[model samples]
Target: MSSHSHDPHILCPHCDLLVTLPTLKYGQKANCPRCKSTLTMRWQEPRRRPVGYALSALFMLILANMFSFVNMNVKGLTSEITLIQIPKVLVADNYASMASLFMVVVQLIPAFCMLAIIMLCLPVRLPGRWNIRIAWILFHLKAWCMVEIFLAGVLVSFVKLIAYGEVGIGTSFIPYVLFCLLQVRAFQCTDRLWLWQQVSPAPAIHQPLKVGQSGLSQGLRSCECCMAILPVKQQVCSRCGSKGHARKKHSLQWTMALLVTSVMLYIPANLLPIMITQALGTKFTSTIMAGVVLLWGEGSYPIAMVIFIASIMVPSLKMLAIAWLCWDAKSSKKVDRERLHVVYEMVEFVGRWSMIDVFVIAVLSALVRMGQLMSIYPDIGALLFALVVILTMFAANTFDPRLIWDRSGTFENKEKFDDGQ
Candidate 1:
């Protein structure tokens, strides 16, 4: 474990355990002993990480958004789908919320992240406060930007549409693909802690606390905003200044509310048509499962499986997992604390990708709008599905995984066992 004079301790974001970081080689991750989340990651040439790639990605993003994404020609009637027009067309079709989210995830967020990276990586000094805000914003933004998943959705939509009409790849398609790849590579190569160290040279240490004494009894608590270890007596985080929470401030209630909303939307999301296709004055509607079945029938088994797993299985699993965690943490006695923490992390991470189907419909709906001969429109289920994805995401975020460990009694005894007998 490495400790400097400036900063001697770090808090586990998952389990709220104070830890001293151990040095690791490039590509190695230091896992928290309690909940097993990656605490520290070492990547090569941290100073250069994601910078060159971000610049390249920025260029690719500009090209990708500036030109049409795809061209669809049906019975001599041609329709071109531009990246800019996708959101415009969506709003025109009264899917304004969907349109806004689509643009934010696919374009605005990624662009902002790329720009933030470039700014952070430049050989220049920036104001520490702005840098911290940018870094914090980029961290959250990464989860919301689903360009890779959106690309997968587009490919699935392409396979479905190619059966009906001629679909031409556009000039921007290659760059968009490259953008996803490089964007992912950039993040893979960047170390978040490394970035933080660079941006904020000064670090404040959290007051130590005996783990066994928790709740209102002990001053120890995890900062909800920055995940920093803080004394409960302190109202604001020494790091992020978010109001300190002895507990997550009604974590269970907010989680349950979001989960309930997801439940209400889930049935409609599955049963209603996700998209409507009108061709030669004939309208056809396809629900989530219907689309999956269509792909299966068309011999696109891989794509079908991807859609079913992403659209059906993933969300189902996330909802069940979150509900199970909540139930077990709040009431059950024999629940494995480590397993619950892992499940909570998985649930939080996986919920964002449910937008895959929504993005697919948006892309297809934007690209294939031909007035009389052919057009595609997102259906009611698409909105509900989008809501389901969104609600679940918020549900996961509202949940505090540390509560699981606290309920497990591990915290109540850690101090007694701190030393080897």
Candidate 2:
């Protein structure tokens, strides 16, 4: 009698081996059987119609900037203001510094970045230098756009404005909301990794051994200098002195340092007011938690839940996960590698959504400027809040999740290849 086992159904891209597909839930992933290369079966591809949506969004963004965001009336005084009016008001009011910062970060930069992305994805030919520059601009812009943060700010301001006096939604507000959604849709459509792939030069491919006694019939030939490799398994090459393939591990100390810093910042981020409002020469500051409480008390349960999740829960969870992973790495703990990887993935996935609070603040500040009647301004806490979210996100990205498996020694020697099984 022969003993038999079921074969996996996964196809490894690195080794071109069809292996068993691990039982994965919707968001789960698996590793290759032969090459040990990780595979994500649940990865989402950009939608096909995102380009169309992006174009529509671009139009809406232009319209939103042109029209007024809010129309407010207080005690027989009425004023209508557009989204672009905010910067003009700031500049005219001699708050040049704030105005410049606001224009660049909140308005000009985001608009140009979105426009650049549209240009890059458009079916048009641009000069190589300009194309490359725009591509780089888009890369940086993707991180700084902060549309979600803007949305959150808008909602918060709306609530505050409605609480005090009459507040009417302007034409610009509708388009601005659509613009945010459009930007998200555009991003989902245009795959950043794929765009990067397109702009990057293709790897130079060399002809494989035709009939020579090259003694190179198995593995890959990789450039040690650049790690450029043909996917096949090869022993040694005369050109590059690279041995078996091994990924560089992230420094444990650096990861731990970042995790510690994230933990330290987490306290102040929750405790300190993320936004302060000044009304009638009196200032009111509200921490992240306070804001949640305020919203909950106001019967805005849905928005409160959103704020609780995005601002409070997600950031705290991300920091803890990073810290745990780093601790495991430092202590050389043999924890569940797959589970650890999943946690890391979850952190990365939710990191950006943490900007929801920031978005709310921005939108609110822009919309609820009613002169002496009602003025909305960002508090010092917003800066710290943004910093906490950004720093934690960076920490999550910097700390390699592979360290979890490396410390566990669960990874087999990747260089070992059998000639005859």
TM-score of each: 0.89, 0.67
**Model 1 off-target regions past 4 Å?**
1-8, 201-203, 206-218, 224-227, 409-421
lDDT of 2 by residue, 1-421 (tens): 2221222222233333333344455434555543344544332433335456667778887898887787766666666777777656655545455456556656677677767766766656686556556766665556656655656656665665566667787878888888888878776556443343344432433444221111123233322222233444443422233343322235556666776786777777777776666667777887878888888888888878888898888988888888887777677545666677678778877887787676566555655565666566666566667677777877875675544544332224433322321
**Local distance difference test, each candidate:** 0.78, 0.59
Q: lDDT at 157 for candidate 2?
A: 54
Question: Model 2 — TM-score against the truth?
Answer: 0.67
lDDT of 1 by residue, 336-418 (tens): 67767778878877777778899889989998888877888998899999899988988988887877867543443332211
lDDT for 307 (candidate 1): 88
Q: Which stretches of candidate 2 lie over 4 Å from their true place?
A: 1-51, 74-80, 85-113, 116-119, 122-133, 192-201, 205-252, 280-283, 366-373, 405-421
